[model samples]
Each structure stands twice: as structure tokens, then as C-alpha cells.
Target chain A: MTDVPESSRTLPKNSGIQEIRLGFTLQHWCLWQSKETPFGEFWPGGEVLPYNGGRADVSFFPMMQSRRLSPLARAVSAVAWHSRQQCGDIPSVFLSSHGESQYYFEILQGMAGGEGVSPSRFSLCVHNAIAGLSSIHNASYQPYLSLAGGTEGMFAAFLEAGGILLETSKVLVVWYEQALPDAYQAYLATSETTFALSMILTRGGGPGHQLRLARRPGKGGSNAEDCTTSLVQTILEGRRSAVCHLEQSIWQWSLDDA
Target chain B: MKNLEAELKQLIIDTLELEGVNPKDIASDAPLFSGGLGLDSIDALELGVALKKKYHIHIDTNSAELANYFASIKTLAGFVVSQQNKSTL
Candidate 1:
């Protein structure tokens, strides 16, 4: 029974359709994973999607600043920075299921070996580290939130992003997760390879795709893919919406392309 | 790899993941800490891990000379040479 933080648990239950003004795939879609079917196969239209993969280059971020990013953060950072580059400054959201479990793993290893923990690892261990670093690198003190919601983290983060969209015209959301190292393999599942998805969403696309979200207490959507990947598929295929049944509730994410 | 000084610079660049930074970019006399590379205590600790892993040399975590050893690329190589020599003997 992992006690979720009050901030995340207290998210507004308002259900509404959200608009994704822009769904961005990395210029480099290094989407490789060993979880039975590679995400590459489900590359949203299997190559017909308008947003194809490209090099996951971060020359945009200075090498000095990017040097310390974890694999998960690196991918998310690239997209986050890209979004900011395209939209100047705006509110941002970051969501991760485990939030740098490897950092925790390493710190524990140090403790067991009678060595002190690394400060860098400790600093980057928090769920908001990605968003925090993005804020620092961009010199933007704009509001941001980092949320952890297990399998539904991606959905929760986007929900918050939609909230931001209410106030601002756009919001940049970066969702990233990586396979836990070998030690955590027993304790955790979904230990797939690295995956990152970024989307710049806006409000009032006006008569485009109607987006809706509801928290009905039942199970229906049995999608096997991760939350973000499923969202990507939904956006790429122009689905009415994606309903992901998380641990405690079902999140119906609808995007009307019509 | 000929010059231990140059080799240590490469190692630092690789271990610390100084992206867009080359060995030549890191001055031998320049400080590697707060004043020079803008690296903090965390980066120093990571570099410490890299050194132990590569050279199998034990580092004195509390030695007074530790700061001097980590002061610059040249100083770090000198420390590595001493430690390596000590291990051989």
C-alpha cells in the first residue's frame, strides 16, 4: 500500500475533453524496447503517422547542462526544450511512474557498502527533477508540477496539464519512463526500455476533436501498452479518446479529430 | 594516450559526461571544482567512482590532499600516477 502524496491524490475530478494542439514525436525516434513487441511496431500508424521519428539530438541544450541528465531525463529534456523553443515560455508538467529508481538503487548500494550517498543522485531522485532542471536551464520560473501515479501517472500528469491549459493557451507535458535496473526487477514490473513522449497542448481548438475525461468506477480498457504510448497511438490514429483503466479508476481520454 | 595528462583529461570528459566538451577544452591548470568547470560536489563524487572503477585505485575520502588532487586535470593525473605506483609496489 504505497501512500500517494496528497497533492496527486487530490487532483480535480472534473472530466472533460482535452485538446492536443500538437503531438510531437522526437526528431529521432530511438524507440527501442524488448517488451515482446517493440514500440517501433506501434509507431502510431506504423509509419503513416505524420510525425515520424528522427535523431534524438540535444545539441539544443548545452552539453554542460545536459551532461548530468539520466537516460530518462535526457529524452524528456530534449522534447521539453524543443517545446519551449517553439513556444517561448509556458507552464510545464512532468510525469514518471518510478521517478529515477536507479538513483535510489545506487544510493542504497552506497549505504550498504558503508559509503555515503551521492548528492547528485539524491538531488535527481525526486519526481520533479526533470521539470526542475528544465526550469533552471531555461531560466523560467513558471509554475510546474511533477506527479507520480504508478501506471496512470502519464494520464494524471496530462490531466494536470489540461488544467494549466485552462489558464494558459498552451502547456508542455513530458512523460518519460525507463526499465528499472536488475535489482528492482522483482519488486517492480513494466521494466521496459526507455520511452519518452512530449506534447504541446492548447485549449479551444474550436470544433476539432472533442476531448473528454471521466472517472467511472469500472474496468473496460485492457490496453497492454504503457500509458504514454497508448496516448500516442490514440493521437496518431485520431481516436475519439483513449480510456486507460488505472489502479483505482478509469481515465477516458478522448480527442476528437473530426 | 601517450601523455598521462592528456589521457586523464579524456577520462574526465567521458566519466563526467561533459557533453560538447573535449579534452583540449579542459585546461590542465584550470580548477575542476566550483571555480572552473562549475561542477559541484556531486560531480566530484561521480568522478571519484569512475576513477576507482577504471584504475582499481583506492581513494582517500578524508585525506587533506584530496582537494589538491581534484583541483585540476593535471593534479588528478598526478594523484592517479601516485596511487597506481603505490599499488604496483
Candidate 2:
């Protein structure tokens, strides 16, 4: 866990602190073994929608199945869906590890083959596509920020969003990641999984929910996908839902039946 | 002429994801925003961006002209056609 700067440690209250609402979407495979199906049992409740060859509309499944979205896109869609469900218009910050991996792989392959990379893929390869898409989706001009760190990606994103909430009244933080495609999966050494979590932070205190800034021990570590899932489960445990931001990860969960 | 209106209506329907709307249902001259179609400000912005990106014509966003541009599918398609013609000329 990196040290949070003293300047960003405290939140300003004059800016109208709002209650944070948290939501999450995860791969069905991850939740199959859990006692409760996180997304299916909660918001947008119903059957577990498949990614490709299924009748139901799996929220973020298309990106994974079609391979159309980069890792960043997966993250962005998660946040966008959550924001649309929550306040309808809130600023967002997205964090990812291997953003646009397939695009980057293709660009590298093109370079190796003496062909230039496609401009479209190049433009979308940046870590901020999620932020850009969120702005477009909400028709909002609010400022957005993006962060990328190796294993510490989620931590960095959480810290930045917490800082923003401290400065403003509210902030939305999103952490998303997808396993790399087969070809580069080995190089990246990540599990073939997809996970997304969103947290809304407000200055005003809320009932049955509190966010504590504390450090327990060595850098909290786990599977990125599982980390996102655990975060959601932890928040959802006590109340219908709450956003939890630990030094390691940020997650939202529902405590009550949805 | 009716077919053209229908085609334009279908385009709007698909583009805007106006659920439960069929091409035959849209009245040609009905207003898109705050009218029969129920499009909102974000839909307007999205439609505007989609038009420019897909059809290669810019739609001005000024308040006075927005009403004229988004009056109906016919109005929007006509505007697009005219912009195409202008670009060619």
C-alpha cells in the first residue's frame, strides 16, 4: 500500500457531500460457486446471462465474447452501467492493468510485420477510453481521470478517487480488468477472468455505512477478479449495499435483497 | 415519399434505441425531442455525434437551430442530404 499524501487525506465538506452508492458486475464463472450469485441475485436480477451464445443480455459479456473491447472498455462499461443506475450524472475515474492488450499485441505484430498500426486501435489503446466513453454516455463534461499500475492498479485508482472525493463532495471510482487473450496471456501471466467494481463516495454520512482509512499489513494481494468480487461481497454483507475502499481494492455490494 | 419517411423513421429508431417504437408508428413531422419520440438531451447529443461521424455532416448545437434540425426523422435526413450535397459542391 502506497502512502496517501497528507494533502489528500482529508475530505472537504463544503462541496455538498453525497451518499455513495456502489454496484458491480462480474463474470458468471466467478460467482457460480458462491452461496449467492452477486449480480444475478442483486440488481438487474434474473437468470445468469451467457457471454456469447445465449438469449439473455449479459451486461458486459459482449465485450468478452466478441473480443471487441480492450480491457479498458470492459472497465468503462461497468462504471457506465453503474453510473446510469445510480445518480445518472457523476464524474468517474477508471483503473486498469493491461489496457487494450489485444490492440497493443496487434500493434506490436504489425510493427514486426512492417505494417503500421491502425489509427482507430491506436487511439482506443489509451488507458482513458473508459473515462472518455463515460463522458459521452452521460452527456457530461465533468472532468475524468485514468490510472494504470502493474499489480497496484486498483490501489492507485482508489487513492486518486478518494482524493477527489475529499476535494469535491462526490466521486465515482471504477476498477476493471480482463484476462489477456491466449497469445499474450502467458506474458501478462493473468487468469482468464473479467471483473468490474464501482464505488460512489460522498461527504455526507450515511446510515449503517462508514469508510475507514486504515492499513492492516503487507500489501493486500489476491486475484484481481476475486479482489473485485470480495469487495462487493463485503459491502453488501451489512446493508443492501455500500461502497468499500480498502488500501488494496474498491468494491460495492448489496446487503438487502434486490 | 412515405417510404422515405419510413426509412428515416427506422434509422432514428435503430440509432436512438427507442424501445417499442416501430417505423410505421412515427408521424413524419412530429418533433423528436419533447414530442412523439421522447428523445432527451443526451439522445440529441448522441444523435448529433453519430450523424457527424456516420454521415460526415456537422449539426450545429445552438438552441435556436436545434429545434429545426431535430424536428423529425425527415428533417434530420433532409439536413444530412443537404449537407452531403454541400460537401460535394
Q: Which residue pairs of candidate 2 clash? A: A236-A253, A236-A254, A239-A255, A240-A254, A240-A255, A240-A256
**Cα interface RMSD of each candidate:** 2.4, 10.4
lDDT value, residue B44 of candidate 2: 66
Worst 10 residues of 1 chain A by lDDT: A43-52
CA shift at A5, candidate 1, in angstroms?
35
Residues A22-105 of candidate 1: C-alpha lDDT, one tens digit per residue: 222222122222132323333221222122243245566777787788767766766677667666787877777787888888
Show where candidate 2 strays beyond 4 Å: A1-75, A187-189, A216-226, A229-258, B1-89
Cα displacement (Å) at residue A50, model 1: 12
TM-score winner: 1
